[model samples]
Target: MTARDLGLPSRVPAPGLPERVTIWEVGPRDGLQNEDAVVPVEVKLEFLDRLADAGLTTVEATSFVHPKWVPQLADAEELLAGLTPRDGVRYPVLVPNERGLDRALAAGVRHIAIFASATETFANRNLNRTLDSQMAMFEPVVSRAVAEGLDVRGYVSMCWGDPWEGAVEPGAVVSVGRRLLDMGCSQLSLGDTIGVATAGHVAALVNAFTDAGTPVSALAVHFHDTYGQALANTVEALRHGVTTVDSSAGGLGGCPYAESATGNLATEDLVWCLDGLGVDTGVDLDKLADTSAWMATKLGRPSPSRVVRALRG
Candidate 1:
């Protein structure tokens, strides 16, 4: 059935309209990046293919970080080289620096994502550098990628709270977001790395960025389910005109630096929420649940996505 058939709302009636929420599935990269058991290259490729087949247009394909840091994705080059390119899907890789950008270029990556943090402590812990240093490094990488005809996406982590520092200021998020946008990033994804944000916080941040002259259309929200608020926060973001969300299949991720936080909002769960709200996601809920379940079996762990478990019954 189409979204209209599902009795979901197509558009909000306010002066601002959140046309459609774009779901960028990150199961292949953020979901599996920290798994203790290394997933095989073929398996990763198959998982990505399944996501594409399920109608995901944007997928975070992989990361080009150091193999020593994340050995699970040590086969980044081989995986990128072997992916069967789909006609309309955009597969973007995460590049932490110029070295990663060079590798992505050599491997024919057409889109790349860079990450920065809002807090100095979280920035140092996650990226091993101060916020300014991280921005300085990514500025040229973003420019070079854009010059080469690649779409650049920038992720600003710890928009809500930081593990080392508490209560990240909204202005801090805006500062990094503006720099990323000015540096030639096509989109800026604000991430609640530790998942401490509430719906109120979500609305506040989205408005803060918009009021600062960054278009709401250029901003996306990424939330962890640590506090069970990702979905609620996503709804708040949509109401405020932020239309893009970053999610992982099976809810399969957690911050390496943030203790006890779970994955981003599950893609299946997000699809279900949007479907119920009459929002068009263009994703098949049952197929996504099946894929997440199959991956859970392969990993010998319970699928973290709530919709997946509920649908399996």
Candidate 2:
């Protein structure tokens, strides 16, 4: 059965849905890092291989943060070394600071991500610094990475409502997003870290950035399903001309700092939606779902993705 045969809409008459959408798979890094059990490096490699084979063009392979912070991905170096890079695939690793960037460069990484929080409280809790201080720390790292000819992506977390701050203003998100782009990030991924954003909030936020002179083309949306709003928020983003969307295979990530946070918007779920909408993701739905189901076994659980469950059944 094809996506069209499944009765999914190929394109909404609405203006924002693009002819093609880029799905940035974050299963390896964001998904596994939050797991209680440590995933072996070999398994990580296999997971990434399957994702690429399943048609994921961009995969967030790992994070180069200190093991004390994300022990599950402490084997970032070994994982990258073992990964067989496929043609037309880009692997990006998360780097929190200069130290993390140095480690990634030593591993021969050419793509990196730097993350910042939109709210002051989450910034202090997650990065151990205020917003200004955190951005200050990232300046040199982003600058150096750009100088090295690396593709850098900046993440603005807690873009909507913050667990500590209640409500986040769109202006605050735009400010940090603009700074990250100015610091040499090729793209800015606005993250709903706690998943409190609604479709309305998403549209407002994306427009705010665009109105502030940041092109929607340079933006991506990273949503969590904590409140079952990730897909809705993603649709809003798509309607706003944002072409990139971030998801974890099998809905496999949560913020360790945000106790209320849940798994990321599942890649399977996103693909299913995109397929139905007749949007081009370049991902094979069955193959993607099978990959998630397979990874779920490695994690010793059923995938949290609704599409995976429905397809498997």
**Positional deviation of residue 114's Cα in model 2 after best superposition, in angstroms:** 0.5
Once fitted onto the true fold, the runs of candidate 1 whose alpha carbons sit more than 4 angstroms away are 1-19
**TM-scores for the candidates:** 0.94, 0.96
Q: What lDDT is reached at residue 47 by model 2?
A: 96
Candidate 2: tens digits of C-alpha lDDT, residues 170-216: 99999999999998999999999989999999999999998999998
- Candidate 1 lDDT score at position 293: 90
C-alpha RMSD values across all candidates = 3.2, 2.1
What's the TM for model 1?
0.94
Q: Alpha-carbon error at 143 in model 1, in Å?
A: 1.5
Residue 229 lDDT, candidate 2, scale 0-100: 93
